[model samples]
Target: MAPHHPEDVGMTAAEQPRQGGKGPRRAVAARDRTRQPTEVRRRLIVDAAVPLIAERGYKSVGVRDVAAAAGVSVGTVTYHFDSVQEVLSEAMVLHIEQYYAALSEAAEHATSGAEALRLLVDALFTEDTDRHWRMWFDFWHAGEQSTDETFARGQADRYTAWHRQIRALAERGVADGEFSGDDLDGFTARFAALADGLALQRLRQAPPLTTQQARHHLNRLIERELVPRSPA
Candidate 1:
């Protein structure tokens, strides 16, 4: 069995998509591997690639490495994925989805919108989340280096979804009277950008930033930003 990926932090085994019955057609699989649904098998291969990329960096991991990590033949990896780029792209998406999943889980039980946002702030700065950040930096770096428009668009889509998540939280707070923001668009932009900056710093370890320190800085910012100030 392939080791569980970060997806397990949020999505239970039952929740990840499984559809040999639908979706676009993939390469013809080997006769021996046919029993595994195409989508499921592809996910297996992609999941295997995540840890390898995390440990080896995106440019360094290859088809052979994925095959070995997946315990499948190199032919099997090629059969399921059209190219190394395709495999890496899918792996990036899968890993990123895990972060959103974990965020949703963190906010699921909060009693108020403010609490949910605070929970999200805490969720974003932990060591476990830091691992996901490493992959995020790599994906963005890859997007920057490649002129592939499709890959760039995918990167934009993921980022847009993240912005949407943050905006939705702020909207929830406003609607419930816990927040008063004059410009959600601006707030969302700044807040997401702040998180991105912190995540990058955490990944670099240039000043030896610890998880506690990261969460503390972000939580303080969240407190100062989210709560409306009283008029003089």
Candidate 2:
């Protein structure tokens, strides 16, 4: 067969303006290319499983539900996972990781520990985080009911990782003289628990906890936790 180029695809170098733009044409072409099959399928499965599991409890969402959501067959879902539990387990891990990535990205711009804390707290008590919080609730409810080994282990891991990140941020505040508590572990635990409680309330409360209201409340809690110290 003769060689084909962009020209063969009805987009020649000269005929189309060589503006070197990432315009819709380029985007469409990118989307048209063959993606890694395994990755594409796995992502489809995870993406489908997440919202369904979040909107409906994981226990309520079956292999058929995931397959329908992903626009695939039950056999396809099974091809990727042994069962719906397995898929939801994987989705939980992905969800937590993505959630942390978002928080970390927001924290990266903060120049001080106090600001970092503010950013983290603000991120949690917002409408944007509502879905993730709901997903966590669904996962917990499902785990409590099924007591699946994989879900249990994944939940433990995510919980540990989340606490670790929060502790690190608290430690940063301590180092910056913005936070003070002799028992840093205790400090972090209290803060984490408060954040979780507030987040849930924000999600479930009618009219919802306004982001500013949550942030102000968290700010006062942090202020109480802070200790005055000379700059390091």
Candidate 3:
């Protein structure tokens, strides 16, 4: 039989108690759901899950926790998502979108594409961004461990988009006569690869690649290939 609503999925034991006929939980749920649109409410759950997952990680976050985080009911979380994994997935997608939006904002505010690239590098390698980095690493690790091919494929798709964004920055640099276009493809791949590698190294912490050092290395790449004249 088709589910009557998005909430019709079989409730787990954890969810059952909260939804039992008439109680504070049910009353609280009623108050929370008053005239809330499905998509808007679902967004609330996902947004709440993002910070929790960022701080607590995927294994630690649960539907109950998300409900508490969102000031909604546990049933509301299950109403929006069929599984904890699905909730986390949606949260990660939001996280990535916000991360990229930050990068774009940093880049867009600059006067030149070279400045944009520099701003992007600076924005990326910051102490404030460590939480973002941790979340991404967690997502990547989940993708690596999952047997589903879509996990890997989705990661690759995100990577491709990241590369394209970097390349677009370089294209702007070239158009402004600030960078050479001779090896744009090669430079894009190298820059993206180096960023990932350096991030992992910094996170690894044995050899201790500082954020400053990472920024310096990325800036040097820009200076070497993209600068119009000798790096100042």
Tell me the TM-score of each prediction against the true structure.
Answer: 0.80, 0.77, 0.81
TM-score quality measure for candidate 3: 0.81
Question: Candidates 1 and 2: which is better by TM-score?
Answer: 1
- Model 2 TM-score on a 0 to 1 scale: 0.77
Per-model root-mean-square deviation over C-alphas? 11.3, 10.0, 5.0
Model 1: per-residue Cα lDDT over 1-232, one tens digit each: 6853322222323434457645444443365334566687789899999998889888999998997787666777777878888899999999888879889877878887778888988888876777788878888999999988889999999999999988888888878787677788888888888888888888888878877787787767666666754544
**Candidate 2: where are CA atoms >4 Å away?**
1-36, 206-208, 230-232
Whose TM-score is greatest here? 3
17 Cα displacement, candidate 1 (Å):
39
State which candidate has the highest lDDT: 3
lDDT tens string, model 2, 83-165? 77888888877887988989988887899877887899888877677788888887776777776776677788888888887
lDDT agreement with native, every candidate: 0.79, 0.74, 0.80
Residue 63, model 1: Cα distance from true site in angstroms? 0.5
Off by over 4 Å in 3: 1-33, 149-151, 227-232
Q: How well is each residue in 1-232 modelled by candidate 3, as lDDT tens digits?
A: 4543543223334444544455432223444335567788889889889999888987788888988888766776777777877888778888888899889988888899889998999988888888888888898888878786756787787888899899999999888877766788888999988888888888788689899999999988877766574344
